[model samples]
Target: MSHVTSPTGLRYHLTHTPPHLTAHSHATLTLTVHNPTPHSIPLPGLTLALPDTPTGTATPHTPGPLTLQPPQGWTTHADSPTHHTLTPPATRDSQPHELPPAGHLTFTLTNYPTSEPGTSTLHLTETPHPGQKGTDNAEPLPLTLTTWPSGTIVNPPTLNKNRYNNGDTATIEWEYSPADGIDYTLTYYPQPAGSGNEKNTVTYAQIQDHSGTAMSNGLRHAVYNTTVPLTTDPVPFILTATYQNDTRTYTTIASVGEPDAQFGKLQVTGHTTLLSTTPQTLTANGSFTSPTEGFLVCWTAPGTAPNKLTVNTNGESRTLSYSICSGSLTLPLAAQSAVSYTADGVSGDQYSVTWIPLGHAINQ
Candidate 1:
């Protein structure tokens, strides 16, 4: 038995000639290879290898080197039992023919056994023309063969909507039979437009019993909450669900057009008209009126401790203390009253008081 490997290149396709072949039956193996690079390359030779099964040994009958004519201009030669070579035909100019870029080559193995129900492999080795160098001398291209399956597999989850608006909740629903020891993981990738970065958020859940049956009509569901910050452009939400060796992906879009209107109403508030010189005395019990809702009293004082503000309202005096930093203090006024605010050692300080009416708290 041989270990089968996958093919590496822009695109490669391998299939059994008769779609389905029973064990010990003979079938043709076809391979199509696409050239992805810009420069023309020397085509590679392919070697087919099959697995040894209890029934019989899966063998490939090798064919002679292939010669292709103009418009194709390529020639293939079997260098050995397990090696083949592809090169441009010799020309009057004596130049080596090369496979055109983006072109494709199809090769077939006439009769190969299915021998066993498992995997078959095809190994491709490049036999360079006279003086070709670099990647042309790279490793062999390995491709695994796909066998017809015995039964049908369940399809991946499907979404009801492909697009959503900002703050929209998306639901992903899927149905599958429960298997012991099998768990599922769902991951969401939020890619903001023009951000050039993908953010991964993952959620894990165990497949639960639906109506006490391994397979049921009721499907499991998950929700993607998009209440947080979103991008300005359409955000792509990619969700991938995985269970053991099988995995599936679903994608949805969240379009965030013009900015949220509520975000624009946020701003700093206060009066800038009052300016006082340092050490200037405020008339004792002087009164300042604020908006009906309230206002934020902000001031800058020297970075020193014991900054004091005394507020006298209705003959009751209270002193508010401030620490070493300069910041703001909220003054909520419910009703009109003769309120006096006096600052000690904060005279001539640059201060601005912004009004914030009731019900205007940004977070609310």
Candidate 2:
């Protein structure tokens, strides 16, 4: 319900009969105009204004012109799809009609579509008759129109990849066809597998249809990209879509896997130096090594902790058993000795290693 008074001492009351309307449905608005002046006034016309159609691929059905039922002896003059003008008989006695002081008129607007779900301000204005001039008789009254949800989700959530290594990028996509007047919301959550707690949730509101036109094939789509960090367990993801008074949700899983081959390479610099107070000796066990360069390999499986290998040289060949642990081995190099070694007993696909000079630092 809404009320507005014009300068001409006329009060207008607006109301939507049913109050709540659904998208793609019909609605009726009733307007009552009251005259409060002491003298009879000539009736002019009325106008109703609606908001522009939503900007996108799907266009709303255009509404037809407005219809007006004037009081007895009054005739409709100007009529347009959204505007109408009514006037009393031009000459008194010639089917003359006028609103006596304190009189009122009631009219209804029917068959309007509530397809788009949202707030629409209907501007109802009273037009002035010829020779009538004043601030009070010409203001437009604002009435709020609200519509509810009448649509559903057409496309569910989908992920580009189900498996990701630490620091890998992944994309999620979904789509929804909106009701005539409703907007949609999308939310995503990434939680650790088997954990009831949610790590984080991302939300997107008023999501627009990427497809410029209505997707005749199915629901329109939207996409989101994210990076997966290293984790011990698989991550469960959830996507939720909401529109008006309705909500839909979906879920999927992503697993963390071992590092790739590129991540397995040992990172170290050459020309590194080693120092020792006493004659230090380094031994290369089942680990693989290069004579002119230092090398070490370390890696962890999807479910296991990470470990590495280290070798020291006394500038001579020495056999040592390798184990998965963190430690430093120092060895003195013999003059002009070509040191070489190999991992003759080590085996596994989950191992990542790095090799550096006996005294050099290792970068993983």
Candidate 3:
């Protein structure tokens, strides 16, 4: 059947028209919901389930677990060991927005059927999608899945990290069936407007294949990447497996970010008076750190080339030394730029530096 229509006049469409997959084979499936009714309708909630220890084919693969990687932008929840409910992201109004009379939405997911080989019937039930802050457990439509027997199935790659900072290291693991020969390639697109885009192919001779476990189809290989640094946000990576002039690509996404350093209190621990050729010091209320190659530079005097005080706050608290023209230095309110630290090694604007004088006004 091309699609299934519910009593509510909502149409459900699954990839492969008839909604079928091969046993022990990995495939990316897409589910689309169409609103064909005269009036607007809510998005149909979807709950996908995988059959455990399926039985149909003669040569069943070793019993293993199933893993599902959902598409981006869907909020997923595991209500049971093998059942997951997929919800759409909330709108700005936090209201249950209705889909236009002729609107539609599509979601994709990658399925890893590594368990016993059999023509197991998969269930993808359609129900009422959850709203702002509630659970939805209503279903009037259901999409059916059928599995066929297969021995040589293409597998998708798995990433070690799901979310990480930009400069973190990650690895990709996948398997390939033994054919005339197999080739592999890795393509990645970093965030921040796709700064780095590159691809590399690994020939069969360069592969260090290992024995397959019960959960894999054929030989397995792992690629360690120390330079999987992301630039801005979550980035998707692709790994292509080519064999017998056919190619299949698998994708995995990883989120990257670095927490911003907060501004802390700095107190002048040394005497209030300072000499032109002498040095001054300040201590932090707590441990200070500069993730980047940045340091704090306090504006000691008001003149051209505002005496750049050298202050290094890497691990422990440090001090600042400057050549101020001996004058009574009164630290103003912290709201002003009395002292600041650089975040990107360029501008000291990320954090505000506050200084609490010891006894009296500081003089240099």
lDDT tens digits by residue: candidate 2, 199-304 = 5555454345233245665556677665335353465556665544334556767676755335466567875454322221234333333443333433333333
For lDDT, candidate 2 versus 3, the one ahead is 2
For TM-score, candidate 2 versus 3, the one ahead is 2
Ranking by lDDT: 2, 3, 1
Best by lDDT: 2
Q: What overall lDDT goes with each candidate model?
A: 0.46, 0.54, 0.50
Q: Candidate 1 versus the native: TM-score?
A: 0.37
What candidate 1 gets wrong by more than 4 Å, as runs, is: 1-46, 50-104, 108-120, 125-141, 145-165, 176-185, 189-198, 203-214, 217-235, 241-248, 254-259, 263-364
The weakest ten consecutive residues by lDDT in model 1 span: 272-281
User: In model 1, what is the error at residue 74, expressed in angstroms?
Assistant: 9.1
Show where candidate 3 strays beyond 4 Å. 16-20, 53-73, 114-119, 126-140, 151-364
Error of 1 at 66 (Å): 19
Candidate 3 lDDT over residue span 1-364, tens digit each: 2357765566777664223455556665566778887788765456776555455445544323434444455678877766679776667887554568888877655544444333344466655554522225444354544444344434677777778765565666666554433456656665455354333344444444332334444555455453545555666667676533235567777677764344599678774432122223344222233322222334333343433333333233334433333122333222222343322222333223334433333332
Reference-based TM-score of each model:
0.37, 0.35, 0.32
